[model samples]
Target: MYFSQNAIILVMLMFVVSAVFYSTINYQTKAVEDEIKIKEVSIYEKNVKNTIDRNINKIVEDAFVNASYKIMKSRKFFPNAKVAVNYITSFIKNETNKSLKCIVGNSSNITFDVGSFDIEPTDDPLKIRVIGNIELRYTERLNNGEIVGLKNIQIDKEVKLSRIPDPYVYLNKFYYKWEYGRKIILNNFPNDDKNHTFCIILNDSNFNYNRMYNENSPTEIRIIGRNSSTGRWNVVLPYWVQTWREGNNHVSIIWVKVNNKELLNVSEDYIYLLYNSTTPVDREDPENTFILFDNFDYFDPDKWNESGEILINNSKLTVVAGAGSSVFSKDTYGEGYELMFRANFSYTPENNSESAGLFNKLDDTGGYGWAYYGDGDFEIVMGDDSYGIDNTFDYINKTYIYDLILNNISNHPYIEYNIYDSTLNLEYSKRETGSFDGTYPISINALPPENKTSNTNITVDWIFLKDVNNITATVGAENIQPITYTEEKPKTFNGVIYYGVGAYDKVYNGTYSIIGLFTNKSDYWKYPTTVGYKPLIEEN
Candidate 1:
């Protein structure tokens, strides 16, 4: 409004100020607009990136799931394909987010199916399945601070479940009892379930179902809840008979029996006391209460050791023929006794014509004599050493020989026991006296060396020799001479000695009947047949 000389200059300056203000405002507005545009681009780019990532995740998950399904179904991971795919999807699937299928696809591609077996298509585990308890357990803890275990588990619905027999071993009635031998203590098992086990007894077995049982011989046994994440429910079956083995187990002892022959003497201490018609038929001597022992039938262990505590040890019976010195408990009777000692064979001389049984004439205390009883006949004569006996006492001059039935008993070849019937029959042979030096406590008249052949099997049977001074040739846990019997007369065991007939094979050592019967002139046993299983006395 002022128009002086100063006013003119002020006015010009005001005009210039106005123009500069206008330019400044315009540039500021443009710059603000550009910043807004840049912000919009940034927002758009972020949205695009997020969408891409989400889509990628979805694809991966779907692929993972599809691959998992194929793997499970085709391989029949579960009982069948139905269970396989269903199980995998249940863990990895998301219905509301079907787009999330790629998660499973990715997971499947990462995992490996190892040790898989053949597949079946028809089975459906869930159709009649029982879902198992979600047992959260420690499967494994990797060093990388990761814990893995079974999850979402379910017990199959169709699995058959049954109770197992009480794994208890007591004094079996027919094996060892108060009246027969002694009350024995057997091990009891399957009684402790602290480990948590569920059993499924199978009513169907390949063998006779009626004979197959628990420790008591149940008809079946199977698995239950075996899919446990822990080791509690899974187990491998065992091979057991009526025998109690030591730490080595029943299976190991079977092999020992096959290798050794001299195991006969040591076998009775800890026997395989069992009865199975299929493979094993060893039972305890059941019948008792008699002094004569006419019947060896036994069942329960309590009947034998009515007062004593009998323990069954399953230690392996490894008896070698030459484990010890051939001359056990024998002292040389000066220089003469030295001549009687021979490893393989020995020579004996004859003495009196009739007074002696064609052997040397030694005094009652000097000569070795045996108490023989057969066909109700009784006599005394010199003991002969021809069988596998090691004549370590060859230094003692053994005179005249008394022969006993040294072959198999009719059909059983594995059994060549000394028959007492004809053993000390002094009248039949060329009697002799004053031969044996009595260095050995027990008179061992072994079979001749020439007679011993791998073809000839040897069996050892035992009985109470029925005399204060009489003892069976073989000594075992179950076989002992009765020092004092409630009733006077002792028990006698009449084992036979015969060989196998050459009709079937050259050597006969035991009973050879596929069907289980008694008929034939063969006095020995043959291959592939269970012999020495029964006593010489038949049970009527």
Candidate 2:
């Protein structure tokens, strides 16, 4: 009985030990499997996280590049920070949706969200910083189970604006905020003259200068000469413009004093002009504002228009009229001009009904003039009749000087005529006519008592409109050729003209001077690109 009981106890003990061993093996196997599963999930999560990070970087980088190009293409430089940041952020989201597939180890179940963007200023003047948030969600299926991964990464990038243009860099190259520019070449310039006052006439025949100035506002025109020694473009100031009319064949007469030592050594240089809302430089009282000066050495079609028989001899313009004839100035005068005529009578009027003399205002409707009648009398005449007669004066063949001045004092405009004998140097007559508010051409006319009967003639020695300042200065004509000489027909000149618009913006609004290497025919102009900017070539 004791042996049997001991055997039973041993069996039971062995059974209990086997059960414990099996339990231990099962527990070990499960622990090892769980560890392997954990490692697999960790590896998959790491791969997805790395992929999301790489894609986020790529998307951000590409957005910056694309935004830069967009800004350049649009020519909207110096945009506000908000605008720039929005551009980058919007591009990134749109591009990611279109392309940018984030996959890790053939796992296609991955998605990302790009959150808001923040922009900050950098130490460099031309650089900016951008920060973005990316939320990535990844799901993958493994042999043991499924793995779900979530990551939130913040991306901070510094964008260098090296590709954009620096406005200050380009503005420093020019003397003014000139809107237009062109190249001019100097040839046959007098080398002997050290200081020359060049008279540059901007006319329709030479260039379309009417388009150069701002009609609605005051215009400041300038000539820029490049310095040979300093290798910099220098501004030429104290320049004068006698006439600047914006009409057909009208002129803008500019006189510039250039120092030979300071002028550009190269054959070509640039001329710049500006339009600003501010008042232009006062050139009215300057010595260089000569309205007109002509010696009549030769017949210049550009200066005079003659009708009937006319002859040029001994520096004289002689007009003979059997019935009626006239010589008139091509340019008409408005309110602020003075006409000086020097002439002698070639043939006095034959009778009381005949007349010959100078006219200050001439048009289709009878003009105001000083006439010598056939009765040895001088008269201030209107059209064919005498208004004010000077019968005491004797009419003879002698040189005489006449002046017609338009006075614009106190807003009341009137015409005054003064007659003097050149030989005696004494004033003969002075008269003030009624106020006339119109433009008229200067003319010399001769009228006979009857058609094709009386011999009426006059010879003009010289005629010129007096300079406004009334001071005489030596004028330089070294490189100025008024019109092409008869010998040099069809010879084109070597200068270009451009008028710019930014002067107004600079003067009135404090805008930066634009970089202009462009030629535009339209009044509107686009800004050009520079250092951190890009420019599209503006076609002429």
Candidate 3:
């Protein structure tokens, strides 16, 4: 195989060129394979990132829906902005944690940790913005290798809540604008004039009269009228009782007078009977206190006892005579009292025994009293002794005032009767010397001429009795308690006070008891607009 020097060199050069060519081809092929590996790794990373981004958004949406449901079902008032925001933030955090388990893309190696949320109020009073930071640790195993990393994702969202109602409106659309502590709202009164004087009935059990009637609060209780003209609350006067009972809910009639220039619209405007004092109020109408005084405005079972066809009609106590009707007071009055009443007859009676007038008794079966008979005779019975006076005036089909005074003079009780026509002109007067004993329960009766067959009846308009022991001066109330001008902090729920919206104000019904009237139907708090939820990405 030996050859010349030139040939040998040529052969060596050829071998070297072949080796270099093969090495270059191998290097180029390795570079191309590395590029393909890099592209695959990049694509896998991008896909994983996209999956996490999509899952994060879905989690936020689900959490928002869950929070909104919880909020709607929670029938509670948000006392202030801080309370509301905290409540909402807590709800969102809880819901997000639950929804974290639903993230897709990785079956087992997926880990999503939802962190604390920051809730902020937007310019729109109805909308609230929520920002959440989530830590995602995802491990993706591929044929090539395993891709492991942690991602911090920030989600920004806005939610709307408008289903809640304002609490202040439930407090009569005015939350202690005039006074605080205890308040009784009165509406549904007749509002035909600018000045209104009317009576309101309240449950005694609901009011703290001890706190209301204190000297420090003498004027502490005020009748604040909602002035429609000024859209403000004005203190009119202190309200007092025309008739009040000490026992629980025993015909407590408080009379209020609002003398504002603007006509009080009872249907639209409410009168706030505010009380926030701890001082005792002096008795201004002590003399006006009566043993019994009823105008028959409403039938109060606590005040009267009736037998047969006795009922109240048009504010009058009507006693039909078909079955021997009678109405008596549940309360009794003592001697030294003036008993006066106004009465009228349905038809004339035909017998002297059939009569209608006032009666007082120490017992149920027998008593001493007086009456005007259908036979045109006025009779008076003392003990068992009875006397009759021939009818000197028309006493049928018309109204008359019968005033009877029973007092002790020189330690001897006497009975004096004065009868007047409807016009208040005296028609008959009488005085009888006698000795009466014991307290008496007053009554009005109608004895049918035929017992159970007569159609004639009697109607008593009103009955009034002075002090149990004696007659006193007339009662006139111009002012009740003095008004206390003091500023006090309003009551709050959970240390936060809530303002009111006019739309949630309830219609005031004077007929309801104080407990029923002040029912807070608007306990559920709400936003001003409709609910909305949208998630938008934000930096940081």
Candidate 1 lDDT over 520-540, as tens digits, reads 212221233333222221211
Query: Mind giving the per-residue lDDT tens digits that candidate 2 earns over 442-495?
Result: 777666665454466777876666422221122222232211211111112132
What lDDT is reached at residue 366 by model 3? 39
Candidate 2, residue 249: Cα displacement in angstroms equals 43
- What CA RMSD would candidate 2 show? 18.8
Worst 10 residues of 1 by lDDT: 164-173
Give per-residue CA lDDT, model 3, range 46-113, as digits (tens): 54446545554444344434433343345343444445445556766776665554443354655666
User: Each candidate's lDDT (Cα)?
Assistant: 0.24, 0.49, 0.51
Q: Between candidates 1 and 3, which one is better according to lDDT?
A: 3
Each prediction's TM-score versus the true structure: 0.18, 0.33, 0.46
Q: Model 3's lDDT to the true fold?
A: 0.51
Off by over 4 Å in 2: 1-289, 346-365, 382-395, 421-425, 466-540
Model 2, backbone clash pairs (residues 3+ apart or across chains), number: 9
